[model samples]
Target: MAGHAGLTTHVLDTARGRPAAGVRVELFAVEGGERRRVAGAVTNADGRTDAPLIERGSLTPGTFELTFHVAPYFEGFEAAPAVPFLDLVTLRFTVSDASGHYHVPLVMTPWSYSTYRGS
Candidate 1:
């Protein structure tokens, strides 16, 4: 379908008050209790992927997952803990409407993280 259906993501480092650049992200499509990787992306300087994880024409109704690799990004900060409290942050969500746009954004720290359905 050539609607606006797509999947996008961004990561913000709340502890450092900046975008968490160079963080690794993996996208997976879940089916029948198995996870199949669909794509991978890396956040840019603006904490956003260069392209949508799922392009407009390619989105569909299904269970999808996004795993953010955060520990290494936090390690660049001076106040980062010796042992990180948060590491791989995985967010699983469902896409019920193929014509809908899904913007999943993450605001994170070394100790905590949060996400929301963005515009």
Candidate 2:
């Protein structure tokens, strides 16, 4: 895995105890003191990104943010109420080590969310 450089992310819907499919994920890097979008992907049925957040041979050590657009997802589902608590959720962290696996997992709900580094 070290030889194949890349970054990955996953989102689990704690409210439903399942993968948060069709959730939009945006990857941004803090470059020159500015946040820039480097990549974007949508969560699949397994709550995992359809592709690596950052592709191989493109990984770099820097501060990064993965913004998950969840509000629209909840609003689209009639089962969920029209008014959701969270509009946009962003997880900011550093990719200090580029050679290793970085798994960012998010467990979220309409009212709250949680995330952590996973293997």
Candidate 3:
């Protein structure tokens, strides 16, 4: 995990125009048609996990999922929709190269969300 050769993520709260602090995020490895928990962390004040969800040495070429607890994160906010449009937001992707860095950043609101590969 030296240099930029692991997996990282960032969460942004579009409604608040800031990082989605303290939000729970989970990483899962998909194998044999089943998903198994790999690692998990809560976003810090900057909406980033303290370390790469997957370290360089631990990463392997495979399919993975990053789940963001969207509804729960917005529960404390007053403007959150009463029923919230999205509960858990899961992004599934494949890693063909274990030594390459993967940056998955989420831009979200109570009603909508978007994710993209980042540098």
Best candidate, lDDT-wise? 3
lDDT of 1 by residue, 19-119 (tens): 98999999999999899999999999999999999888788999998999999888867788888888899999999988888999999989999999887
Error of 2 at 29 (Å): 0.5
- lDDT sort, best first: 3, 1, 2
Q: What is the TM-score of each candidate against the true structure?
A: 0.94, 0.88, 0.94
Off-target runs (Cα >4 Å) in candidate 3 are: none
Assess each prediction's global lDDT (C-alpha) against the native.
Answer: 0.91, 0.85, 0.92
Q: How far is candidate 2 from the true structure (C-alpha RMSD, Å)?
A: 1.8
Candidate 2 TM-score versus the reference: 0.88
**What residue pairs are clashing in model 2?**
none
Candidate 1 minimal-lDDT segment of 10 residues: 1-10
Give per-model CA RMSD.
1.6, 1.8, 1.5
* Model 1 C-alpha lDDT versus the unseen true structure: 0.91
User: How many clashing pairs in candidate 2?
Assistant: 0
